[model samples]
Target: MLQHPKYIVRRLQPADAPSFYAAVRESVDELTYWMPWCSKDYSLSDAEAWMQSTSDMWAAGAEFPLGIFDATTGEVLGGTGVNHINRAYRIGNIGYWVSSKRTGQGIARFAAHESAVLGFGELGLTRLEIVVLTHNRASQRVAETVGAKLECEARNRLYFQGSPHSAFVYSLVPEDVR
Candidate 1:
């Protein structure tokens, strides 16, 4: 478990599949812009398979997938990850989602901040970017709250719910945190 009192950002486990599926089900519609893979009728089997693949990637040092947990009860609160790690460039992108019931309470901001610290201090990543759907002010706030600077507008960058939408690309460097 991570050191944060409100939440723990830890790697995904096979045992978390059920809770993960439950959270996904609870937030399916609201997460369309927040979650890149949000879609119809996500299942427990899919969560299990994803956990396996993600765990393997973390073990192989190829990527990191973190599940935010309630610090006291160890309940899976949501999911976050650093995918497409580029060692040569010392960079990675952060993607995350929070349970709808858990939103607007600073949980996503807390998790994303801790993840950013881990990426820089432990993983030695020098650059991180968070891409938020143009209209997702809540998520954009999370990105800015974590010290990432608004970089550019990525036109037609995301395809969510069968429609092309633009994204605001926010970026951070090690110095930004300091």
Candidate 2:
């Protein structure tokens, strides 16, 4: 777990289903624009299933799904994690989303930075990548703030919702964080 003055970042748990559901519901409209999995009909069952999958992935050492929470009140702020793990290659993908109410507060960047530290220091990953839609300036800014370099742009590199979207790929190494 990573603690900050404003928020705490930690692994997802089964007990977080309700709060997670609520947060996602509140942010659904904004999230749907960038997150393929988000939609108007997202339900509590989906949140529960996602939490379960996260636990399973963690146990299998395949992915690390984390939650960002308010430090004092413990309200769910958003989600961030090092996923798409490639253990043999020592690489992982970083992804994050903040509740619309929480955007512009640097929460995504801070949580992403902490996720990178965990990826490099605890997970022994050598490289972490953050792929942002070409139109997603906010996410690109977060990547830059976390010291990820723009490596390239790939055609239809991301599969969102159902269709493929091109993205600007950014990467970071341990030295970049240090």
Candidate 3:
């Protein structure tokens, strides 16, 4: 677990499903535009399945999907992960989102930076990427605030909502964080 003064970042557990469900339901409207998995039809069962899948992937060393939570109350604040790993090159992609109610509160930024620390310090990653949709200015800000350098706007870098979209690709190396 990664402890922060404002929050904690840790692997998801089955017991977290209820909070995850509530968070997703609250944020689905905002999340739907950027996250393909979140929708009006999202259910608690989906959250449970997500927790399970994340756990399975972690066990397999395939991915690390984690939760951002309140340090005092354990309420779900957001989610972040180090995914799309290149183990041979020690690189990974960092993705994150905050609950709608917590937008503009720096939770996403905090969770993202801590996730980078996790990637570099424990996951042994030398490089991490923050790929955000070109239109997502909020996410872009989070990447920049976390000290990731804007490498370029790559063409067709992401597929979202059944279409290809260009993305701002940011690079975060060990030095970028420390």
What is the alpha-carbon lDDT for the whole of candidate 1? 0.84
- All candidates in order of lDDT, best leading: 3, 2, 1
Q: What does candidate 1 score on TM? A: 0.91
Could you tell me which 10 consecutive residues in candidate 3 have the lowest summed lDDT?
1-10
Q: How are the candidates ranked when ordered by TM-score, highest leading?
A: 3, 2, 1
Query: Going through the candidates in order, what is the number of backbone clashes in each?
Result: 0, 1, 0
Candidate 3 per-residue lDDT over residues 1-178, each given as its tens digit: 6688889999999999999999999999998888988888999999999999999999999999999998999999889999999999999999999999998988998899888998998899999999999999999999999999999999999999998989999999999885
What's each prediction's TM-score? 0.91, 0.96, 0.97
In model 3, which runs have C-alpha deviations exceeding 4 angstroms?
none
> Over 4 Å off in model 2, which ranges?
none
Candidate 1 vs candidate 3, lDDT winner:
3
lDDT (tens digit, per residue) of candidate 2 on 1-178: 6688999999888998898998999999998877878888999999999999989989998889899999998888899999998888999999999998889999999999989999999999999999999999999999999999999999999987678889999999999995
Cα deviation in Å at residue 27, candidate 3? 0.6
All models: lDDT?
A: 0.84, 0.92, 0.93
